[model samples]
Target: MTTMAATRRMGRQSWRIFSMQARRCSVAHDHTSSSDPKLTNFGYREVPENEKSKLVGNVFTNVARSYDLMNDLMSMGLHRLWKDRLVSKLHPFPGMQHLDVAGGTGDVAFRVLHAIHKAEHRAVGKLGGKSEAKNETRVHVCDINPNMLEVGKQRAHKLGLENVEDLVWMEGDAEALSLEDNSMDGYTIAFGIRNVTHIDRALKEAHRVLRRGGRFLCLELSHVSIPGFQQVYDAYSFAVIPAMGELVSGDRASYQYLVESIRKFPSQEKFAAMIADAGFQEVQYENLVGGVVAIHSGLKL
Candidate 1:
């Protein structure tokens, strides 16, 4: 089938699944005493909520080796542009402290450091100051996947980042961050929020961790708004992506699940509302690459 036709079919299938879910919920409410085990949909799979992390972990573990490659291939290297845009908006100061939650491979953290260094260099050149400058910037990269964190740590070391020891690689859940409250100057997550089963809780955690006026930034795959982009995008995601995964990572099913999860993710407006509900103010989003991805920015006030 053509890309357009395939996308239409998938949209229809998604609608059917939604309808089925509504019917099931209605029936369950009617039979309150029924002992039918409750089921939650995790990317079209009916699984218990508690089981989702393990399943998601398996997907990441399977694709960890080729995850970065897949990102480059799928986005035609535009993912770098999207991330750069996010970093630009952040405009990290030399003294800023950031918590990068779900920062699986420290891509965002590394970019943040680069932005800070560039900003500092520009400031010094503009001012022509001879005073000693202090680099107070620090980033804590937190993720649930230790394997990903280990790889990221090695990459950081290879880059010869002076404060590599300052970059804490913590294994923690977004829903319940282990960090102390009101301790972070900024919080960021890239392409990670959708994998979270409890997005609201995660947002709450973000709010709790961020200091007043601190920024919360998220870069995620969002629903496309263009006339024909969704169809083409879906076709590529569903068809070519898995094949690329097989070729690069020797894992096809993991990539397939990633595509489905992106489809299951909430719309940009819906997600912005969720962020607002979690006490973030001035919530805004910028679409990248014809709305295939979005960078959402909000502040804790």
Candidate 2:
């Protein structure tokens, strides 16, 4: 046989081997050895779909007390500004019925509630008299982790809002919200959807719970694609975040998983497409911190 022919044959064999290995890895990563379809990602590893939530719950339970502190240290307190930007995009108003899922710490919920009150007060003052009807606004804070919810409740008490009639806390799963159809005027989830086992199901649930013309907004850590900045951002994420998590929360493994989870999540465009597929319209997103985080928005219209 000619040397060139032998080279061609060798190339074909190498390609076949590569393809076979890639397929095997893909199947194993998405399913068990028995080819079970009920497997999902837990960070970089694959696990039973039913177990992901419990694993995630334990992680949060371990760090619930220091979650906020870790956020401050890791992001240099920019999380607050990112959340405030989310609320401003929400355009909250009086009499709004908002559901803040995966927001057990009440960060987003508190901002929505405060925005509603400020808007209500401004309208009341403009009318030159107090309205007879009280503001019927409600902000429901929901999370899958009870420990995180307890942290939010304590914060509310510290702020003297424990007795506030408009605030409600519920422990609920994002993929299967207990809310009625057409129930909420707005839905927001900050840094939460990435932790869900089925992000598409959670998006559909967000659409289901929202009334017509309602909006869905999500704030999450996302991929970076800038020229030189991407490398710097990645280095910080992999090295500094876990260290900060250990120093502040004493849970290095959980923070390491969190960083890997962000990498495993879909890109901003792909996630926006998923939201649109979930029956949301007018889908859009804004990248913050050069794509360290992204805020995706959609309307139920």
Candidate 3:
């Protein structure tokens, strides 16, 4: 699949809020830049609004090779469990069309495909639905980073899914999807929504692309709620995670940015509200690991 980027000029109000968040994140990260009338946040640092996506792309590029490794190390292998939970919630089946946006690593797509295979295998014996089992299922793995897309393709190949015609790698922007409206049965963005420059716009695109009764699910790092555990989590996020990134990926700044971006994201309730504002129904979120990660789900009703 071809990759397409979404770039648009920011409105006055949105730009103003983004600018202030950039400055606040800068102060927190201790990376000060000159005051500019036009700016956006690049992991706690303010840069030209137009340059933010490029800077973010560079960060992901630098760590693309080590992204999964760092995820395991930083989360102590919990990322996999979190992702598995997300896939379980998706409940993919034969003939389903899923769009795994921002899942450049193909984890979500892989799990869903495997689940479909498992489900079809079981139903084939009892129902003799061999033809149904052979349906052309598709999972479009879309991301903004080409490097990440390459990694995901390599992973799919490694998994012996090279013969599968269903997995398609696409480089796309979440804010403005290249896909047709109401074309997909399900939309998933795991650990990807927080990276979007405009989370609400991304949600709107998700709404647009999903057919009626389709599901929209997003898994992301969120604020920790446990009283004492919050402090412990913060220390680990600020200190240990970045150090691990430096040692493993040789890029502490990128991991530092990761931590700060999580900090800057809206809380569970607030984010759910944004999803509702984007015109979803029955918007709700499940807090995982004491809200260190959250899974928000809605239906395009």
Best-fitting candidate, measured by TM-score? 2
Candidate 1: which pairs clash? none
Per-candidate TM equals: 0.85, 0.88, 0.86
The digit string of per-residue lDDT tens for model 2 on 128-206 reads 8874444578899999999999999999999999999999999999989998999999999999998998787899899
Q: Each prediction's Cα RMSD? A: 5.1, 10.8, 9.7
Per-candidate local distance difference test: 0.77, 0.83, 0.79
- The residue-by-residue lDDT of candidate 3 on 98-133, one tens digit each, is 999999989888998898888778778778658474
Q: Pick the candidate with the highest lDDT.
A: 2
**Model 2 misplacement above 4 A:** 1-36, 131-133
Report how far off residue 282 is in candidate 1 (Å): 0.6
Candidate 2 least-lDDT 10 residues: 7-16
* Superposed Cα RMSD, model 1: 5.1
TM-score, model 2 to reference: 0.88
Residues 129-234, candidate 1, lDDT per residue (tens digit)? Answer: 8324434667889999988887788788788863565467789999899889998989999999878766778889999999999999999987775546565666
